[model samples]
Target: MAAYYSQNNPDPSPTSLTFAYPQTMDWNRELLRNEPGMLAEEKLSDVERLKVKIRMFARFIGMKGAETPRWEYERGVEILARRIERRVRLEEETEMRRKVFMGPRAWQA
Candidate 1:
C-alpha cells in the first residue's frame, strides 16, 4: 500500500466532479426541496409521514388493493380536478404577486 500515500503524482488532482447538463442553483434547490431528503426536518416520524402520504395518495387514485366502484372512480377524478383548480389559483396568485412586486406590466392590477 506504498502507492496509497507516496506523493501519488501530485495527488491525482481530485477527478473533476462535473454535471453532464448544466443547471442553476435555484433549479437544483427546487428539486431537492421536493425530494425525500427534506424529511430530516420533520418532528413526526418518517413512517407516520409516509403512511399518511400513502393514504392521501391512495385516496386520490383509488389504490389497487382497495376494491373501488365506478362512482368512486368518477369522484376521484372530480376531486383531482378540484385540486388542480386550487393549485392553479394559488399559482396565479403567486404570479400576480411577482408581477406586482416586479412592477413592469402596465395592465396588471
Candidate 2:
C-alpha cells in the first residue's frame, strides 16, 4: 500500500538496516573476567579455619554465646578450647579408622 511504504520506507531504494541491539561481542566476557585484589592466595591456618567453621556453626544454630560471652576473657579462650577438643576427637577418629583399615600390620608398625 502507498500509505504503508510512506510510513515504513521512504524513497523505496535498497538500504542497509541497523539493529537496536547489536550482537558483536559476548556480554558475559566482562562479567567472567577476574581481577586479583587483596584476596588471600594461601589457605587459612588450622586454628583460623576451625574458628571460622565454629563461628559459622554458632551463627547457624543462633547461639547466644556468639553474641555475648559468659566470661569476659579476651580472645574467646572458651570457644577456642571447645574447637581444640572437637579437632582432637576428629583426629583420633581418623587415626582409629586408618589403623582399623590397615589391620594387624599397622599395630606392628
Candidate 3:
C-alpha cells in the first residue's frame, strides 16, 4: 500500500494557500467602537452587566458560608468590587499606553 501510494503521489509540496481580505477598510473605526474593555458600564449589554453583578453576588455568598455575618459578607463584596474596578482601570490605562507607543498605523494590514 505504501509503495503504491508513493508511486501515485509524486509531488510532496503543499497545496496553495488563499488569503481572504475584508470587503471594507473600516476595521479600525469598528474596533474602537466595539472594544469591550473601553466600553462604559452603561454601554455594556444586559447579559454582561448581569454577569458582573452575579460575580459580586457569588463572591459574597462564598465569603458568607455557614457562620459568616452579614457585615463580613457585605465587606467582602465591597473589596471584590474595588479590586474589579482597579483591574478595569489598569486595563484601560494599558490599552491607552499601547496605542500611544504603537501609533494608529500599527493596526493597518
Candidate 4:
C-alpha cells in the first residue's frame, strides 16, 4: 500500500482523503462497484445519510426552498452535522477493525 501512503500522505490528516466526499458518493453506481461497507449494512446506511445531508444542505444554502417558515436553516445545518458525525464514527470503527485483522500486513497490502 505504498501507493496509498504516497498519495494520501500529501495531507497529514485522515480527513485529507477527499475520495470520500461528494462527487465520489455516486449513488447510481451498482452495489458491487462501490467500496464495501465496514459493517454489513454500513455502506447503505452511509448513502442514505449522505443523501439526506446533501438535500438538507441544499435547502440550508437556499439552493432549494419550501413555503414553510418553520423549517429554518439552522435546523437543517444541525441535521447535516449529526449525519457527518455518525458517518465518521462508523468509518473509524471499521478502519480499526481492518487494521486489527490485517495486523502489520495491512500496510503492506
The CA lDDT of each predicted structure is 0.46, 0.48, 0.48, 0.51
Model 2: how large is the Cα RMSD against the reference?
A: 20.0
Q: Model 1 compared with the native: what TM-score?
A: 0.33
**Per-residue lDDT tens digits of candidate 3, residues 1-109?**
3333343345675223211221243323321133556534323344544444555455545645335346545544655575588789999999998778575577683
Q: lDDT by residue for model 1 over 1-109, one digit each (tens)? A: 2344343335645333322222232423221233454333322244533444455456555567544445435544554565567779989999998677555564574
Model 3 spans with C-alpha error above 4 angstroms? 1-66, 102-109
TM-score of each: 0.33, 0.28, 0.33, 0.31
Clash statistics: count for each candidate: 0, 0, 0, 0
Report the CA-based lDDT of candidate 3 relative to the real structure. 0.48
* Ten residues in sequence with the least summed lDDT for candidate 4: 25-34
- For 7-40, candidate 4 gives per-residue lDDT tens digits of 5467555544445333343434432222544333
RMSD of each: 14.2, 20.0, 20.1, 17.3
TM-score of 3: 0.33
Whole-structure CA lDDT of model 2: 0.48
Candidate 4 residue pairs in clash (backbone atoms < 3 Å): none
Clashing pairs in 1: none
Local error of candidate 2 at residue 101 (angstroms): 2.9
